[model samples]
Target: MPIYGSASVAESGPQATVRVPATSANLGPGFDSLGLALDLYDEVTAEATSGTAVTVEVEGEGEGTVPTDERHLVAATMIRTFAHLDLAPPGLKLKCRNRIPHARGLGSSSAAIVAGIMLADALAGAGLTRTEKLALADAIEGHPDNVAPCLLGGFTIAYSTEDGAKAVRLDPSPRIHPWVYIPQVKGLTSVARAALPERVPHADAVFNLSRSALLVAAVSRQPSRLFEATEDRLHQSYRAEGMPESTRLLHDLRTAGIAAAISGAGPTVLALAVDDAELPEAPEGFEARRLDFGSGAEQVATSRRE
Candidate 1:
């Protein structure tokens, strides 16, 4: 376990507003490692109050569907983060405005987790470094791919180390444009993971290894190679049966020479294209839109007691 050591404690009634971006993980062959932050976002405002109750107000995305109590993902993460800092706030109030679609491989959960950690850190004046925050977020989310881009933004390559999760951020090529296709039905990451095979052939492993490396170069500098760099043999095909529409769309886009892949444990498909490339229309039951690469999570506002 990583310990959070705070040099200073904030006064009571500290409040902070944080905005975290949605992330797309496994951008092709880099399963559990590659991620890109999207312009879609979830914003949270947190205030430390005077009692033990936790209250949450939500708008958009999961407004009525998600829990509004401590059981909520952001609230729960905040509570845990406060505990780690050895600071006990009497109570907490959170207001969440979400735009990222849940369980559609757009990283709604990662955004929530990052939002909570950032809010707690800002309010408590914990002064945790970005590395520390990444470790904490990765622990909560169980992987660094989504959390990495949600925290650091841009294009990221995340990996685990003995110390914790670490990542490198790279600016994506300006010429590469991204478009997402979101489905009306939701996806469950757990179900998708269960659909994967325990062992793949050695040749398949080698195939993904080469493309994953190529994907890094393609995204960073060689936009022309994206179509080839995004090819994979590790996860998508294995999970395709569960998401026919997404899989079919991915296939259609790729066949037309677009770089397309499943986003995270997706029912959503992410298509990458360079300048002036025309993408096909979204299939029925899906909504499509172009998105810019996102910047990292930011603390939009904070109120500190005198």
Candidate 2:
């Protein structure tokens, strides 16, 4: 669990402030519809001053594997954020500590995209509303499910239409618990997405539509008809092909009477279980974590020179 702290420094001033939570999407049949904000986090600190270089420092996840230069995810997105607003790069220094695992079904890249954009807006003194932030986030992430919950918190139902995106925030009550089972390997979002077929049959579409509605109803009102509401016949099937462990976990969980769904385009499964279930809270058997559904994203200042 990573927590991003406040910022205090002397230079140009506070550039931007943002802390985004990791998200689990498509819980059951809520494809591109439902998403939950988790407690794991990634914090970003960005500052703009009079200088010529763009410097980035990363701690945690990609410490040695990633470049600490302009090529970094945060810096690259930061540049895009400011440039989109017609602001020149003012010698930025970015520091990020990542706690969320990368390349997993979790929204790691989405968090970075969001944190960078929000940080840039805050630092440049640019004005943008939460709705505007959602729009930008939707554009960068290419989907609204993950970004919606990360920006708005709780459980969200978001989708892209001809008019852009239509999103709504649902009450992420504490009644239901999320039981996660992460396999030993990380799954790629691109690969999971690519596995989807060009078109689905009408029967499958109708089946998913009904199940998606049931899933939303269950999330909106707990003590839900657990087993029935958490079933899917769409994306998860093909998506699971690339990560067989996810499909296996779902089967095993059902056999144990626990309803489960692929957490986003996942290698991880978000099972419907009581917080006090027989499963351990740690990574012992299948590496799991019990997550609360009510927590959302927050904005906070993170750093500057000492």
Candidate 3:
């Protein structure tokens, strides 16, 4: 069965509960293309109700801060998805349990968008094909890297086509282990992106291209080549000023022979290890944790009105 299948509906109104994993994009050289799903997750339960009113409740990561009405990201995306499918919007009550940290280069926004799309499809039994769902999500998120892994799981390479955004997933080698260093300070993707140069040297472009290809091989089969494969001449150095601490941490880890890179836009760092590698002490404001590769977004449960 597909990962995000329709929910089981009975005599009562339809409801769905979905779990989406956190994702890290641009794993070094494959900027705006590569992504990996992490074991961390955010779960959302959405129920269709009688009236047009929309209500939302959030716990864990984004508790009191995010919007509680239709303006919430998940609710808003659901409304958009219904319109995309040419279906009337339904009254909704959403309960979000978020674990992925917001603005921490951990694909939190992509997770919310995917959750909304999945919930709408399940509740309405829209029967959207996987490609249709991916296109819709990539359109909304403005990129496929994070959303691809959040939806398809494992390792993903996202690219745009004439139709829309598309991706392919690959299982990472068993020897590859992931460790994340999350800083207390959150980063704005906008700020990090703004730091990049509009153009890079042709030689630099060649540098990243070769490593990007090698990165696929290293992540898929040759875990030993990860250190070399993860090297990049694009993006990271340009973004260093905005995330000095993350840059420093990445350097330290790589210096110690671990394959380290700034996760997404940064302030967080991801280290790919092939053994029981000893990690350095977390910086003053960072927390270090090990995470396994995640599967895909899943419809975990369903509810019916009694």
Best by lDDT: 1
Q: Name the runs in model 2 displaced over 4 angstroms.
A: 1-15, 280-285, 302-306
Better of 1 and 3 by lDDT: 1
How do the predictions measure up, each by TM-score? 0.95, 0.88, 0.95
lDDT of 2 at 259: 72
Candidate 1 segments exceeding 4 Å error? 1-11
Q: Estimate candidate 3's RMSD in Å.
A: 3.6
Instruction: Return whichever of 2 and 3 wins on lDDT.
Output: 3
- The candidate, 1 or 2, that scores higher on lDDT is 1
Task: Give the alpha carbon lDDT tens digit for every residue of 177-292 in model 1.
Answer: 88999999999999999999999999999999999999999999999889889999999999999999899899889989999999999999999979989998898999998999
Q: In what order do the candidates fall by lDDT, top score first?
A: 1, 3, 2
Candidate 2 local lDDT, 124-204, one digit each (tens): 657767777777777777888888888877778898777566678888546677766776688888888899888989998
Candidate 2 lDDT at 28 equals 74
Whose TM-score is higher: candidate 1's or candidate 2's?
A: 1
